[model samples]
Target: MNVYSPNLELARMVLDSQPFSMYLGARLTAFGDGGATLELDIRDELRQQNGFVHGGVLSYAADNALTFAAGTVVGPAVLTAGYSIDYLRPARGEVLRAHAQVVRPGRTRVVCRCDLFTVDSEGNQTLCAVAQGTIAVAETALPEPVE
Candidate 1:
């Protein structure tokens, strides 16, 4: 499959068009052919009762990064079919990053793996979560009345 990097304009468009992504404040940090990195600042809203970044927040970031990376290979019309995540450590930092790489690209499905890390004020990296997802290419356009 041909690989092409998405420009910042395209990345912003993708991020703005996605409703759930907007809700999570996901920002596209970098994008390449079959890879992408998303970032989110850990705020009080993202924390769980323990005062650490919630696992669900990490999962959402990872999943978003994986899906965006896969979309760079396939088109932007892909949707997540299945996803699984593993939490390794708690996130105790002020910022978080999710880096995703495309594992397998197919006509119907694209598989991606994402690694979520927390970056401390000292610029140290801590492995927080790992996620794998399969995105299916949309067969048809969404519901819209045609003229």
Candidate 2:
């Protein structure tokens, strides 16, 4: 069976419209062909007591990136079913980049892997975290428009 797919434009629109995306100050930097990249600045608010990016923030960004990557292959109806995250190093930098790629695209599910990197002012990137997520298509009934 053929699966649904969403182009970069539609993926960006859908991601930007999400409330959590606004809350996290997440931006869809790039999206295309079963892949997606998101960027987030490590402002004071997003840092922990040690002046490093918070773990939760990295996880959130990674999750969103993976979801968007899966959406590129599975379309807008897809929803994240589960995710596993691993923090390799502290994210201490000015910005964080989350890059995701679809590992497997199936009829009903899409599996994605993401790498979160901390980029310094000098453009040095350090691998901070890695995540794997599974997204599955969801079916929902839409209400008819009222006249």
Candidate 3:
């Protein structure tokens, strides 16, 4: 199955603009047609005390994936209004992946759902969490990028 979006380059640029996303090494691997996928390699720093991937990391992926999915339909100037995530399992793998799609698209707001997964070395993916979010069109433009 083809997962890449035609707008991958533009979406990746937007993802790279976020300091936190860059810090986590997250990549916008796919985006467009009201869907998006974010991926991050698992690292020692992203683990919890028990050795599983941190919940916050998963939440971050979900939130960003949801917003990106919304962006495919609502355009670039958008913000995540709010979101809720349910952790389904402990994530222990080589990489973390979040796939999201717009549940509903609107002029002023968009609803999205995301599924978080952990991919093992052998390419097995385990569902770790699920999320739903509401994205709103930004009333003001985003600030200029820092030089």
Candidate 4:
């Protein structure tokens, strides 16, 4: 089942190119043939009025993780076509981890699902959100935005 080999260094470099992800301190903790995990330390600035991790943050994690998972199977050039997420609980913890896996892999598109979890000081994880996304393969990397 391990048909694809993952390049952690390449993945890290790709993530580092993303300013938003770098600003959030999100790191690629794990990457494999058809799975990836992104994690970020929780900060007060990332919290909402309810003192829970903001939904936007969770969404970003899910989106990136899902796309990265698909990238494992479909190469590096890919974009998220669309995705849906469901919040299961308010997230409050020391770290947020998003784990994603490819459900189906094809030449042009890949389906991925992600589970967002909150990890407490004791290292217990609580699932707070779930997401599913479709990734579209690209022939080449997208052009950088004009500043």
Which candidate wins on lDDT?
4
Q: Locate the minimum summed-lDDT window of 10 residues in model 3.
A: 1-10
Root-mean-square deviation of every model? 3.1, 3.1, 4.0, 2.5
Cα lDDT computed for each candidate against the true fold: 0.85, 0.84, 0.91, 0.93
1 against 3, candidate with superior TM-score: 3
Using all chains and alpha carbons, the TM-scores for the candidates as numbered come to 0.88, 0.88, 0.93, 0.93
lDDT of 4 by residue, 71-142 (tens): 888678889999999999999999999999999998889999999999999999999999999999997877
Q: Give lDDT tens digits, candidate 2, residues 1-147.
A: 555656777666676777777777788888878899999878998889988899989989988898889777766676789999999988998889999999998877899999999999999999999999998867763232242
Q: So what's the TM-score on candidate 3? A: 0.93
Off by over 4 Å in 1: 1-5, 141-147
Q: How accurate is candidate 4 locally (lDDT)?
A: 0.93
* Stretches of model 4 off by over 4 angstroms after superposition: 1-4, 143-147
Lowest-scoring 10 consecutive residues by lDDT in candidate 4? 138-147
Q: Where is model 1 poorest over a 10-residue stretch in terms of lDDT?
A: 138-147
Q: Write one digit per residue (lDDT tens) for candidate 1, span 48-116.
A: 999999988888898888888988887677788989999998888978999999999998999999999
Better of 3 and 4 by lDDT: 4
The list of candidate 2 runs beyond 4 A from truth reads 1-5, 140-147
Better of 1 and 4 by TM-score: 4
**What lDDT score goes with residue 116 in model 4?**
97
